[model samples]
Target: MRTGMTLLIKFILTFVSAFIAFDLLLNNDISWILLLSLVAMLINYLIGDLMVLPAKGNMIASIGDGLLAAITAYIFDLLIPAFTTSWSTLLWFAILIGIAEYFFHLYLKKDEKVAP
Candidate 1:
């Protein structure tokens, strides 16, 4: 693939993944997901080499993302008197993230195999 295309996909996927993860963060509203995603993306981008493989990078990202997502969800629930959450919200968030991850991986791998 062309370098430009790869970078573009990376930019788009990063935004999509972050947005979905942020939404999954709550039944109500909280903004911490924004900060958390920014932090995680920055840290990972800076240390991308340390991750070595896609799986390793994903593992690290997932931990940071998942924890931050949970915190954001909880905080949103805490602040909004009218908002309610289910214990299952966490599970749904996890599932949604997992799906997002799988698709992102597929897209990346496909891009790598295709001609520029």
Candidate 2:
């Protein structure tokens, strides 16, 4: 649960989840999805994890992450012609990312505790 490790896991999870989520939900170019995932992950980690998690709790932080993911995806889809998406698709991506984020937030918390 060191900072480095946590960030690594966060990046990996974000990348994988976003990649797969978009792949499953949208008709889009792989390159566009990858780019979008990186952007979303950066924002999610910065705002959702760094900002929200410390101020709020895991649930709120996870929700925030989901919201951020949904917004990011929507914006990207609008901007990128090849990235197609819908409301239901966005919600599905959010839900999936949020569940994964919850566990990542838990991992952060575990890192802070005193080991027995």
**lDDT for every model?**
0.48, 0.81
Candidate 2's C-alpha runs over 4 A off are 1-4, 112-116
Clashing pairs in 1: none
Instruction: Put down candidate 1 lDDT per residue, 1-116, tens digits, no spaces.
Output: 47556445544544445555445544334344444445433443334312422546555555544444445555555875654456676555545544444454455556655332
Candidate 1 differs from the real structure by a C-alpha RMSD in angstroms, to one decimal, of 6.5
- Could you tell me every candidate's TM-score relative to the true structure? 0.41, 0.86
Candidate 1 accuracy as lDDT: 0.48
Candidate 1 colliding pairs, count:
0
lDDT of 2 by residue, 9-72 (tens): 7777876776667776565677877787788888998898788988999999999899899899
Best by lDDT: 2
Tell me the number of clashing residue pairs for each predicted model: 0, 0
